[model samples]
Target: MVGDAHRAPETAAGRLGRRLLTGWAVLGFVYLFIPIAVIVGYSFNDPAGKFNIIWRRFTFDNWAHAFERGPLTEAMVRSLQIAGIAAIAATVLGGLVALALARYRFRGGALIEILLVLPLTTPEIVLGASLLSLFIDLDQQRGFWTIVIAHVLFCTSFVALTIKARIRGFDWTLEDAAMDLGAPPWRTFSRVTLPLIMPGILAAALLSFALSIDDFIITFFNAGTTETFPLRIFGASRNEISPQINVLATVVLLASVALLLAGVAARARVEGRPVVVLTDTDG
Candidate 1:
Protein backbone atom coordinates (compact mmCIF):
# COMPACT_ATOMS: atom_id res chain seq x y z
CA MET A 1 0.00 0.00 0.00
CA VAL A 2 2.88 2.44 0.83
CA GLY A 3 4.86 1.58 -2.42
CA ASP A 4 1.71 1.93 -4.53
CA ALA A 5 1.03 5.39 -3.10
CA HIS A 6 4.60 6.61 -3.85
CA ARG A 7 4.57 5.17 -7.43
CA ALA A 8 1.23 6.83 -8.16
CA PRO A 9 2.54 10.28 -7.23
CA GLU A 10 5.76 9.78 -9.24
CA THR A 11 3.82 8.65 -12.32
CA ALA A 12 1.52 11.65 -12.02
CA ALA A 13 4.47 14.00 -11.74
CA GLY A 14 6.15 12.50 -14.85
CA ARG A 15 2.93 12.84 -16.86
CA LEU A 16 2.56 16.43 -15.70
CA GLY A 17 6.13 17.22 -16.77
CA ARG A 18 5.55 15.69 -20.21
CA ARG A 19 2.33 17.65 -20.65
CA LEU A 20 4.08 20.88 -19.66
CA LEU A 21 6.89 20.20 -22.14
CA THR A 22 4.40 19.45 -24.89
CA GLY A 23 2.54 22.67 -24.18
CA TRP A 24 5.78 24.65 -24.27
CA ALA A 25 6.75 23.07 -27.60
CA VAL A 26 3.32 23.92 -29.06
CA LEU A 27 3.63 27.51 -27.82
CA GLY A 28 7.12 27.82 -29.31
CA PHE A 29 5.91 26.69 -32.74
CA VAL A 30 2.94 29.09 -32.55
CA TYR A 31 5.20 31.98 -31.58
CA LEU A 32 7.58 31.30 -34.44
CA PHE A 33 4.84 30.93 -37.06
CA ILE A 34 2.59 33.82 -35.98
CA PRO A 35 4.52 36.40 -38.01
CA ILE A 36 4.57 34.08 -41.03
CA ALA A 37 0.81 33.58 -40.68
CA VAL A 38 0.34 37.34 -40.58
CA ILE A 39 2.42 37.75 -43.75
CA VAL A 40 0.40 35.07 -45.54
CA GLY A 41 -2.93 36.44 -44.34
CA TYR A 42 -2.13 40.01 -45.36
CA SER A 43 -1.07 38.83 -48.83
CA PHE A 44 -4.78 38.69 -49.76
CA ASN A 45 -5.60 42.02 -48.13
CA ASP A 46 -6.31 45.07 -50.28
CA PRO A 47 -5.25 48.26 -48.57
CA ALA A 48 -6.23 51.81 -49.74
CA GLY A 49 -3.16 53.66 -48.45
CA LYS A 50 0.45 53.58 -49.70
CA PHE A 51 1.27 51.38 -46.72
CA ASN A 52 -0.19 47.88 -46.89
CA ILE A 53 -0.20 47.61 -43.07
CA ILE A 54 -3.90 48.35 -42.66
CA TRP A 55 -6.32 45.67 -43.82
CA ARG A 56 -9.05 47.21 -45.99
CA ARG A 57 -10.62 44.19 -47.68
CA PHE A 58 -9.84 40.83 -49.26
CA THR A 59 -8.94 40.99 -52.95
CA PHE A 60 -7.34 38.77 -55.62
CA ASP A 61 -5.97 41.81 -57.46
CA ASN A 62 -2.66 41.60 -55.62
CA TRP A 63 -2.12 38.04 -56.81
CA ALA A 64 -3.17 38.87 -60.36
CA HIS A 65 -0.93 41.93 -60.55
CA ALA A 66 1.96 40.51 -58.53
CA PHE A 67 4.60 41.11 -61.18
CA GLU A 68 3.11 44.41 -62.36
CA ARG A 69 5.41 46.21 -59.98
CA GLY A 70 8.24 46.81 -62.46
CA PRO A 71 11.11 47.65 -60.13
CA LEU A 72 10.15 44.96 -57.66
CA THR A 73 9.88 42.37 -60.40
CA GLU A 74 13.24 43.37 -61.83
CA ALA A 75 14.84 43.25 -58.42
CA MET A 76 13.40 39.80 -57.80
CA VAL A 77 14.74 38.57 -61.13
CA ARG A 78 18.17 40.03 -60.34
CA SER A 79 18.15 38.35 -56.95
CA LEU A 80 17.19 35.02 -58.53
CA GLN A 81 20.01 35.26 -61.07
CA ILE A 82 22.54 36.15 -58.41
CA ALA A 83 21.32 33.35 -56.13
CA GLY A 84 21.47 30.76 -58.92
CA ILE A 85 25.02 31.62 -59.91
CA ALA A 86 26.21 31.88 -56.34
CA ALA A 87 24.62 28.55 -55.36
CA ILE A 88 26.21 26.74 -58.28
CA ALA A 89 29.65 28.16 -57.55
CA ALA A 90 29.39 27.55 -53.82
CA THR A 91 28.13 23.98 -54.24
CA VAL A 92 30.97 23.04 -56.60
CA LEU A 93 33.71 24.51 -54.41
CA GLY A 94 32.19 23.32 -51.16
CA GLY A 95 31.52 19.82 -52.45
CA LEU A 96 35.16 19.52 -53.48
CA VAL A 97 36.29 20.67 -50.04
CA ALA A 98 33.89 18.23 -48.35
CA LEU A 99 35.09 15.33 -50.48
CA ALA A 100 38.73 16.16 -49.76
CA LEU A 101 38.11 16.48 -46.05
CA ALA A 102 36.04 13.31 -45.80
CA ARG A 103 38.25 11.08 -47.95
CA TYR A 104 41.75 12.19 -47.07
CA ARG A 105 44.10 12.62 -44.11
CA PHE A 106 45.88 15.83 -45.00
CA ARG A 107 48.06 18.41 -43.26
CA GLY A 108 46.21 21.42 -41.82
CA GLY A 109 42.91 19.52 -42.22
CA ALA A 110 41.56 20.71 -38.87
CA LEU A 111 42.66 24.26 -39.58
CA ILE A 112 40.90 24.22 -42.95
CA GLU A 113 37.71 22.87 -41.43
CA ILE A 114 37.85 25.50 -38.72
CA LEU A 115 38.36 28.21 -41.35
CA LEU A 116 35.31 26.98 -43.26
CA VAL A 117 33.18 27.01 -40.09
CA LEU A 118 34.40 30.43 -38.97
CA PRO A 119 32.35 32.32 -41.56
CA LEU A 120 29.20 30.53 -40.39
CA THR A 121 29.91 31.31 -36.72
CA THR A 122 30.89 34.93 -37.39
CA PRO A 123 28.33 37.72 -37.33
CA GLU A 124 26.81 38.56 -40.72
CA ILE A 125 27.23 42.30 -40.08
CA VAL A 126 30.92 41.80 -39.41
CA LEU A 127 31.30 39.64 -42.52
CA GLY A 128 29.49 42.27 -44.57
CA ALA A 129 31.65 45.13 -43.26
CA SER A 130 34.81 43.10 -43.76
CA LEU A 131 33.89 42.18 -47.33
CA LEU A 132 33.02 45.80 -48.04
CA SER A 133 36.38 46.85 -46.72
CA LEU A 134 38.20 44.14 -48.68
CA PHE A 135 36.54 45.29 -51.90
CA ILE A 136 37.39 48.91 -51.13
CA ASP A 137 41.01 48.00 -50.47
CA LEU A 138 41.23 45.96 -53.65
CA ASP A 139 39.61 48.75 -55.70
CA GLN A 140 36.98 46.22 -56.78
CA GLN A 141 33.60 47.42 -57.92
CA ARG A 142 30.83 46.57 -55.40
CA GLY A 143 28.20 45.26 -57.77
CA PHE A 144 26.87 41.95 -59.07
CA TRP A 145 30.13 40.03 -59.06
CA THR A 146 31.04 41.35 -55.62
CA ILE A 147 27.63 40.27 -54.33
CA VAL A 148 28.14 36.82 -55.85
CA ILE A 149 31.61 36.56 -54.29
CA ALA A 150 30.35 37.55 -50.85
CA HIS A 151 27.41 35.11 -51.11
CA VAL A 152 29.69 32.30 -52.24
CA LEU A 153 32.08 33.03 -49.37
CA PHE A 154 29.36 32.51 -46.75
CA CYS A 155 27.43 29.76 -48.54
CA THR A 156 30.49 27.64 -49.30
CA SER A 157 31.01 27.06 -45.58
CA PHE A 158 27.41 25.91 -45.09
CA VAL A 159 27.48 23.69 -48.15
CA ALA A 160 30.81 22.11 -47.20
CA LEU A 161 29.57 21.46 -43.65
CA THR A 162 26.22 20.03 -44.73
CA ILE A 163 27.71 17.75 -47.40
CA LYS A 164 30.48 16.68 -45.03
CA ALA A 165 27.88 15.66 -42.45
CA ARG A 166 25.95 13.62 -45.01
CA ILE A 167 29.06 11.91 -46.39
CA ARG A 168 30.70 11.21 -43.06
CA GLY A 169 29.23 7.73 -42.54
CA PHE A 170 29.37 6.83 -46.24
CA ASP A 171 30.85 3.46 -47.24
CA TRP A 172 33.95 3.82 -49.41
CA THR A 173 33.90 0.09 -50.22
CA LEU A 174 31.27 0.84 -52.84
CA GLU A 175 33.77 2.97 -54.74
CA ASP A 176 36.43 0.26 -54.35
CA ALA A 177 34.00 -2.33 -55.63
CA ALA A 178 33.27 -0.25 -58.72
CA MET A 179 37.01 0.12 -59.38
CA ASP A 180 37.55 -3.59 -58.87
CA LEU A 181 34.93 -4.19 -61.52
CA GLY A 182 37.42 -2.68 -64.07
CA ALA A 183 35.90 0.83 -63.92
CA PRO A 184 38.29 3.76 -64.27
CA PRO A 185 38.67 6.30 -61.43
CA TRP A 186 36.47 8.92 -63.09
CA ARG A 187 33.97 6.25 -64.12
CA THR A 188 33.81 4.84 -60.60
CA PHE A 189 33.32 8.28 -59.11
CA SER A 190 30.59 9.14 -61.59
CA ARG A 191 28.79 5.79 -61.30
CA VAL A 192 29.22 5.11 -57.60
CA THR A 193 30.20 8.11 -55.51
CA LEU A 194 28.29 10.84 -57.35
CA PRO A 195 24.89 9.13 -57.14
CA LEU A 196 25.32 8.45 -53.41
CA ILE A 197 26.35 12.05 -52.65
CA MET A 198 23.95 13.77 -55.05
CA PRO A 199 21.17 14.16 -52.48
CA GLY A 200 23.47 16.00 -50.06
CA ILE A 201 24.77 18.17 -52.91
CA LEU A 202 21.23 19.00 -53.98
CA ALA A 203 20.22 19.84 -50.42
CA ALA A 204 23.28 22.06 -50.06
CA ALA A 205 22.46 23.81 -53.34
CA LEU A 206 18.89 24.49 -52.27
CA LEU A 207 20.06 25.84 -48.92
CA SER A 208 22.65 28.07 -50.61
CA PHE A 209 20.03 29.39 -53.02
CA ALA A 210 17.64 30.21 -50.18
CA LEU A 211 20.37 31.87 -48.14
CA SER A 212 21.60 33.93 -51.09
CA ILE A 213 18.10 35.09 -52.01
CA ASP A 214 17.25 36.10 -48.43
CA ASP A 215 20.59 37.72 -47.59
CA PHE A 216 20.25 41.43 -46.87
CA ILE A 217 23.07 42.72 -44.67
CA ILE A 218 25.96 41.34 -46.74
CA THR A 219 24.29 42.38 -49.98
CA PHE A 220 23.55 45.81 -48.57
CA PHE A 221 27.25 46.58 -48.11
CA ASN A 222 28.40 45.01 -51.39
CA ALA A 223 25.46 45.74 -53.72
CA GLY A 224 26.61 49.26 -54.62
CA THR A 225 23.79 50.84 -56.70
CA THR A 226 22.34 47.45 -57.69
CA GLU A 227 19.07 46.71 -55.90
CA THR A 228 18.20 43.08 -55.18
CA PHE A 229 14.73 41.99 -54.06
CA PRO A 230 15.42 42.36 -50.32
CA LEU A 231 17.07 45.75 -50.76
CA ARG A 232 14.17 46.92 -52.94
CA ILE A 233 11.62 45.80 -50.36
CA PHE A 234 13.53 47.51 -47.53
CA GLY A 235 13.73 50.76 -49.53
CA ALA A 236 10.09 50.56 -50.64
CA SER A 237 8.86 50.11 -47.06
CA ARG A 238 10.08 53.59 -46.23
CA ASN A 239 8.32 55.33 -49.13
CA GLU A 240 5.53 53.07 -50.42
CA ILE A 241 4.75 49.63 -49.08
CA SER A 242 3.03 47.65 -51.80
CA PRO A 243 0.65 44.69 -51.56
CA GLN A 244 2.74 43.15 -54.31
CA ILE A 245 5.50 42.67 -51.73
CA ASN A 246 3.16 40.54 -49.65
CA VAL A 247 1.99 38.67 -52.74
CA LEU A 248 5.53 37.88 -53.78
CA ALA A 249 6.43 36.87 -50.25
CA THR A 250 3.43 34.52 -50.08
CA VAL A 251 4.41 32.97 -53.41
CA VAL A 252 7.95 32.37 -52.19
CA LEU A 253 6.63 30.84 -48.98
CA LEU A 254 4.38 28.49 -50.92
CA ALA A 255 7.25 27.54 -53.20
CA SER A 256 9.53 26.84 -50.25
CA VAL A 257 6.82 24.71 -48.59
CA ALA A 258 6.35 22.77 -51.81
CA LEU A 259 10.08 22.18 -52.08
CA LEU A 260 10.24 21.03 -48.46
CA LEU A 261 7.41 18.55 -49.06
CA ALA A 262 9.08 17.33 -52.21
CA GLY A 263 12.37 16.83 -50.36
CA VAL A 264 10.58 14.86 -47.64
CA ALA A 265 8.89 12.67 -50.23
CA ALA A 266 12.16 12.12 -52.06
CA ARG A 267 13.95 11.18 -48.87
CA ALA A 268 11.16 8.76 -47.93
CA ARG A 269 11.33 7.15 -51.34
CA VAL A 270 15.10 6.88 -51.21
CA GLU A 271 14.99 5.28 -47.79
CA GLY A 272 12.26 2.87 -48.94
CA ARG A 273 10.00 4.08 -46.13
CA PRO A 274 6.40 5.17 -45.97
CA VAL A 275 5.62 8.63 -44.72
CA VAL A 276 3.89 8.58 -41.34
CA VAL A 277 0.82 10.75 -41.51
CA LEU A 278 -0.47 12.20 -38.27
CA THR A 279 -4.14 11.34 -37.80
CA ASP A 280 -6.68 9.50 -35.68
CA THR A 281 -6.10 5.87 -36.61
CA ASP A 282 -8.05 4.47 -33.68
CA GLY A 283 -11.61 3.33 -33.90
Candidate 2:
Protein backbone atom coordinates (compact mmCIF):
# COMPACT_ATOMS: atom_id res chain seq x y z
CA MET A 1 0.00 0.00 0.00
CA VAL A 2 2.97 2.26 0.56
CA GLY A 3 3.90 4.34 -2.53
CA ASP A 4 0.79 3.00 -4.30
CA ALA A 5 -0.33 5.18 -7.18
CA HIS A 6 -3.95 6.27 -7.48
CA ARG A 7 -5.22 3.78 -9.99
CA ALA A 8 -8.27 4.42 -12.11
CA PRO A 9 -9.59 3.79 -15.58
CA GLU A 10 -7.26 5.71 -17.86
CA THR A 11 -8.13 7.64 -20.96
CA ALA A 12 -5.91 7.64 -24.09
CA ALA A 13 -4.67 11.12 -23.18
CA GLY A 14 -3.71 9.92 -19.71
CA ARG A 15 -1.89 6.91 -21.17
CA LEU A 16 -0.10 9.15 -23.65
CA GLY A 17 1.00 11.50 -20.83
CA ARG A 18 2.30 8.61 -18.71
CA ARG A 19 4.23 7.22 -21.67
CA LEU A 20 5.73 10.62 -22.37
CA LEU A 21 6.85 11.01 -18.74
CA THR A 22 8.37 7.53 -18.62
CA GLY A 23 10.20 8.13 -21.91
CA TRP A 24 11.46 11.48 -20.61
CA ALA A 25 12.84 9.85 -17.48
CA VAL A 26 14.58 7.22 -19.58
CA LEU A 27 16.06 9.92 -21.80
CA GLY A 28 17.37 11.83 -18.77
CA PHE A 29 19.01 8.72 -17.34
CA VAL A 30 20.59 7.92 -20.69
CA TYR A 31 21.93 11.45 -21.03
CA LEU A 32 23.47 11.29 -17.58
CA PHE A 33 24.97 7.80 -18.00
CA ILE A 34 26.14 7.98 -21.61
CA PRO A 35 29.39 9.71 -20.68
CA ILE A 36 30.01 7.21 -17.91
CA ALA A 37 29.33 4.42 -20.36
CA VAL A 38 31.83 5.93 -22.76
CA ILE A 39 34.44 6.15 -20.01
CA VAL A 40 33.96 2.50 -19.03
CA GLY A 41 33.99 1.42 -22.66
CA TYR A 42 37.17 3.36 -23.42
CA SER A 43 39.02 1.66 -20.59
CA PHE A 44 39.06 -1.53 -22.61
CA ASN A 45 40.20 0.23 -25.78
CA ASP A 46 43.78 0.36 -27.02
CA PRO A 47 44.75 3.69 -28.49
CA ALA A 48 45.13 3.88 -32.25
CA GLY A 49 47.60 6.72 -31.94
CA LYS A 50 47.89 9.37 -29.21
CA PHE A 51 44.18 9.30 -28.64
CA ASN A 52 42.38 6.89 -26.31
CA ILE A 53 39.06 8.05 -27.74
CA ILE A 54 39.52 5.89 -30.81
CA TRP A 55 38.32 2.28 -30.43
CA ARG A 56 41.04 0.34 -32.17
CA ARG A 57 41.20 -2.91 -30.17
CA PHE A 58 40.08 -4.25 -26.83
CA THR A 59 42.57 -5.51 -24.28
CA PHE A 60 42.80 -6.20 -20.56
CA ASP A 61 46.21 -4.55 -20.25
CA ASN A 62 44.92 -1.21 -19.05
CA TRP A 63 43.02 -2.80 -16.20
CA ALA A 64 45.95 -5.01 -15.39
CA HIS A 65 48.41 -2.13 -15.32
CA ALA A 66 46.10 0.44 -13.79
CA PHE A 67 48.79 1.64 -11.41
CA GLU A 68 51.70 1.53 -13.87
CA ARG A 69 52.26 5.26 -14.04
CA GLY A 70 54.37 6.36 -11.06
CA PRO A 71 53.26 9.99 -10.87
CA LEU A 72 49.65 9.11 -11.46
CA THR A 73 49.72 6.36 -8.87
CA GLU A 74 51.41 8.58 -6.32
CA ALA A 75 48.96 11.37 -7.03
CA MET A 76 46.01 9.00 -6.69
CA VAL A 77 47.32 7.65 -3.38
CA ARG A 78 47.83 11.19 -2.12
CA SER A 79 44.34 12.13 -3.19
CA LEU A 80 42.88 9.12 -1.39
CA GLN A 81 44.80 9.94 1.77
CA ILE A 82 43.70 13.55 1.66
CA ALA A 83 40.09 12.60 0.96
CA GLY A 84 39.99 10.11 3.84
CA ILE A 85 41.44 12.54 6.36
CA ALA A 86 39.28 15.43 5.19
CA ALA A 87 36.17 13.29 5.25
CA ILE A 88 36.72 12.14 8.84
CA ALA A 89 37.66 15.63 10.02
CA ALA A 90 34.72 17.24 8.24
CA THR A 91 32.25 14.59 9.35
CA VAL A 92 33.12 14.91 13.05
CA LEU A 93 33.15 18.71 13.02
CA GLY A 94 30.05 18.95 10.87
CA GLY A 95 28.16 16.35 12.91
CA LEU A 96 28.79 18.33 16.09
CA VAL A 97 27.78 21.59 14.40
CA ALA A 98 24.60 20.02 13.03
CA LEU A 99 23.76 18.49 16.42
CA ALA A 100 24.30 21.81 18.16
CA LEU A 101 22.13 23.66 15.65
CA ALA A 102 19.41 21.02 15.75
CA ARG A 103 19.40 20.16 19.46
CA TYR A 104 19.87 23.50 21.24
CA ARG A 105 19.08 27.17 21.00
CA PHE A 106 22.25 29.21 21.13
CA ARG A 107 23.42 32.72 20.36
CA GLY A 108 24.41 33.41 16.74
CA GLY A 109 22.70 30.20 15.57
CA ALA A 110 21.09 32.05 12.66
CA LEU A 111 24.40 33.67 11.80
CA ILE A 112 26.09 30.28 11.88
CA GLU A 113 23.45 28.91 9.49
CA ILE A 114 24.05 31.80 7.10
CA LEU A 115 27.79 31.32 7.28
CA LEU A 116 27.37 27.62 6.47
CA VAL A 117 25.40 28.54 3.35
CA LEU A 118 28.04 31.00 2.14
CA PRO A 119 30.70 28.43 1.20
CA LEU A 120 28.25 26.44 -0.91
CA THR A 121 27.12 29.58 -2.76
CA THR A 122 30.59 31.05 -3.11
CA PRO A 123 32.43 30.37 -6.34
CA GLU A 124 35.27 27.87 -6.13
CA ILE A 125 37.62 30.41 -7.64
CA VAL A 126 36.82 32.92 -4.90
CA LEU A 127 37.25 30.34 -2.14
CA GLY A 128 40.53 29.14 -3.65
CA ALA A 129 41.88 32.68 -4.04
CA SER A 130 40.88 33.65 -0.50
CA LEU A 131 42.33 30.47 1.01
CA LEU A 132 45.52 30.90 -0.99
CA SER A 133 45.88 34.45 0.31
CA LEU A 134 45.26 33.32 3.88
CA PHE A 135 47.90 30.63 3.52
CA ILE A 136 50.37 33.11 2.13
CA ASP A 137 49.61 35.51 5.02
CA LEU A 138 50.27 32.66 7.46
CA ASP A 139 53.30 31.53 5.44
CA GLN A 140 52.04 27.93 5.57
CA GLN A 141 53.46 25.56 2.98
CA ARG A 142 50.92 24.25 0.49
CA GLY A 143 51.16 20.49 0.48
CA PHE A 144 49.30 17.41 1.73
CA TRP A 145 48.15 18.90 5.02
CA THR A 146 47.16 22.16 3.32
CA ILE A 147 45.11 20.28 0.74
CA VAL A 148 43.41 18.26 3.48
CA ILE A 149 42.72 21.46 5.44
CA ALA A 150 41.28 23.18 2.40
CA HIS A 151 39.10 20.17 1.64
CA VAL A 152 37.87 20.07 5.24
CA LEU A 153 37.03 23.79 5.02
CA PHE A 154 34.81 23.42 1.95
CA CYS A 155 33.49 19.95 2.79
CA THR A 156 32.33 20.78 6.35
CA SER A 157 29.39 22.78 5.04
CA PHE A 158 28.23 19.93 2.85
CA VAL A 159 28.43 17.46 5.71
CA ALA A 160 26.63 19.78 8.12
CA LEU A 161 23.81 20.59 5.71
CA THR A 162 23.33 16.95 4.75
CA ILE A 163 23.20 15.73 8.34
CA LYS A 164 20.95 18.63 9.31
CA ALA A 165 18.47 17.63 6.65
CA ARG A 166 18.60 14.01 7.83
CA ILE A 167 18.10 14.80 11.50
CA ARG A 168 15.37 17.36 10.98
CA GLY A 169 12.24 16.36 12.95
CA PHE A 170 14.22 13.58 14.61
CA ASP A 171 13.02 12.52 18.08
CA TRP A 172 15.47 13.62 20.74
CA THR A 173 13.20 12.06 23.37
CA LEU A 174 14.86 8.70 22.64
CA GLU A 175 18.20 10.10 23.79
CA ASP A 176 16.61 11.64 26.88
CA ALA A 177 14.83 8.39 27.65
CA ALA A 178 18.08 6.46 27.40
CA MET A 179 19.72 8.88 29.76
CA ASP A 180 16.77 8.57 32.14
CA LEU A 181 17.33 4.81 32.15
CA GLY A 182 20.63 5.38 34.03
CA ALA A 183 22.87 5.51 30.95
CA PRO A 184 25.76 7.96 31.10
CA PRO A 185 25.80 10.86 28.64
CA TRP A 186 28.51 9.23 26.57
CA ARG A 187 26.77 5.86 26.61
CA THR A 188 23.41 7.36 25.71
CA PHE A 189 24.95 9.29 22.88
CA SER A 190 27.01 6.38 21.62
CA ARG A 191 24.12 3.94 21.89
CA VAL A 192 21.11 6.04 20.96
CA THR A 193 22.04 9.37 19.42
CA LEU A 194 24.89 7.94 17.39
CA PRO A 195 23.00 4.97 15.92
CA LEU A 196 20.13 7.25 14.98
CA ILE A 197 22.41 9.68 13.16
CA MET A 198 25.07 7.30 11.84
CA PRO A 199 23.46 6.88 8.44
CA GLY A 200 23.47 10.60 7.78
CA ILE A 201 27.04 10.85 9.01
CA LEU A 202 28.16 8.01 6.74
CA ALA A 203 26.42 9.55 3.76
CA ALA A 204 28.01 12.92 4.50
CA ALA A 205 31.43 11.33 4.91
CA LEU A 206 31.17 9.55 1.58
CA LEU A 207 29.99 12.72 -0.11
CA SER A 208 32.82 14.75 1.36
CA PHE A 209 35.34 12.13 0.26
CA ALA A 210 33.95 12.09 -3.27
CA LEU A 211 33.95 15.88 -3.49
CA SER A 212 37.47 16.16 -2.11
CA ILE A 213 38.81 13.51 -4.46
CA ASP A 214 37.12 15.08 -7.49
CA ASP A 215 38.02 18.68 -6.60
CA PHE A 216 40.39 20.39 -9.01
CA ILE A 217 40.04 24.12 -8.56
CA ILE A 218 40.56 24.42 -4.80
CA THR A 219 43.17 21.67 -4.84
CA PHE A 220 44.91 23.25 -7.79
CA PHE A 221 45.15 26.65 -6.07
CA ASN A 222 46.34 25.23 -2.76
CA ALA A 223 48.46 22.30 -3.95
CA GLY A 224 51.93 23.71 -4.43
CA THR A 225 54.36 21.16 -5.95
CA THR A 226 51.86 18.42 -5.19
CA GLU A 227 49.55 16.54 -7.50
CA THR A 228 46.18 15.01 -6.63
CA PHE A 229 44.44 12.51 -8.88
CA PRO A 230 42.44 15.24 -10.61
CA LEU A 231 45.51 17.47 -10.87
CA ARG A 232 47.50 14.55 -12.22
CA ILE A 233 44.84 13.79 -14.81
CA PHE A 234 44.78 17.41 -15.95
CA GLY A 235 48.58 17.50 -16.16
CA ALA A 236 48.69 14.17 -17.98
CA SER A 237 46.06 15.33 -20.48
CA ARG A 238 48.42 18.06 -21.60
CA ASN A 239 50.83 15.31 -22.63
CA GLU A 240 48.72 12.23 -23.43
CA ILE A 241 45.42 10.81 -22.27
CA SER A 242 45.83 7.20 -21.25
CA PRO A 243 43.30 4.40 -20.85
CA GLN A 244 44.62 3.81 -17.34
CA ILE A 245 42.87 7.00 -16.29
CA ASN A 246 39.59 5.55 -17.43
CA VAL A 247 40.35 2.24 -15.74
CA LEU A 248 41.11 3.78 -12.39
CA ALA A 249 38.08 6.05 -12.72
CA THR A 250 35.82 3.10 -13.39
CA VAL A 251 37.16 1.40 -10.26
CA VAL A 252 36.45 4.49 -8.16
CA LEU A 253 32.97 4.80 -9.65
CA LEU A 254 32.14 1.17 -8.93
CA ALA A 255 33.55 1.37 -5.42
CA SER A 256 31.55 4.48 -4.59
CA VAL A 257 28.38 2.92 -5.95
CA ALA A 258 29.00 -0.24 -3.96
CA LEU A 259 29.54 1.73 -0.78
CA LEU A 260 26.34 3.68 -1.28
CA LEU A 261 24.33 0.57 -2.00
CA ALA A 262 25.78 -1.16 1.05
CA GLY A 263 24.88 1.81 3.21
CA VAL A 264 21.33 1.84 1.85
CA ALA A 265 20.89 -1.85 2.52
CA ALA A 266 22.33 -1.54 6.02
CA ARG A 267 20.11 1.38 6.84
CA ALA A 268 17.05 -0.40 5.54
CA ARG A 269 17.88 -3.36 7.73
CA VAL A 270 18.47 -1.22 10.78
CA GLU A 271 15.24 0.75 10.27
CA GLY A 272 13.15 -2.33 9.37
CA ARG A 273 12.15 -0.76 6.07
CA PRO A 274 11.60 -2.54 2.84
CA VAL A 275 14.83 -3.29 1.05
CA VAL A 276 13.28 -2.40 -2.30
CA VAL A 277 10.72 0.39 -2.29
CA LEU A 278 8.98 -0.30 -5.57
CA THR A 279 6.34 -3.01 -5.63
CA ASP A 280 4.06 -4.61 -8.17
CA THR A 281 0.30 -4.96 -7.73
CA ASP A 282 -1.69 -7.82 -9.13
CA GLY A 283 -5.13 -7.61 -10.62
Highest TM-score scorer: 1
- Candidate 2 lDDT over residue span 170-214, tens digit each: 888877777677779987777777767888898899999999999
Query: What's the lDDT for all of these models?
Result: 0.90, 0.88
Tell me each candidate's TM-score: 0.90, 0.89
Provide the lowest-lDDT 10-residue window in model 2.
274-283
Residue-level lDDT tens digits of model 1 in 197-225:
88899999999999999999999999998
Candidate that scores best on lDDT:
1
Q: Candidate 2, clashing residue pairs? A: none
Residue 128's lDDT within candidate 1 is 98
Error of 2 at 227 (Å): 0.3
* Candidate 2 wrongly placed segments (more than 4 Å): 1-11, 273-283
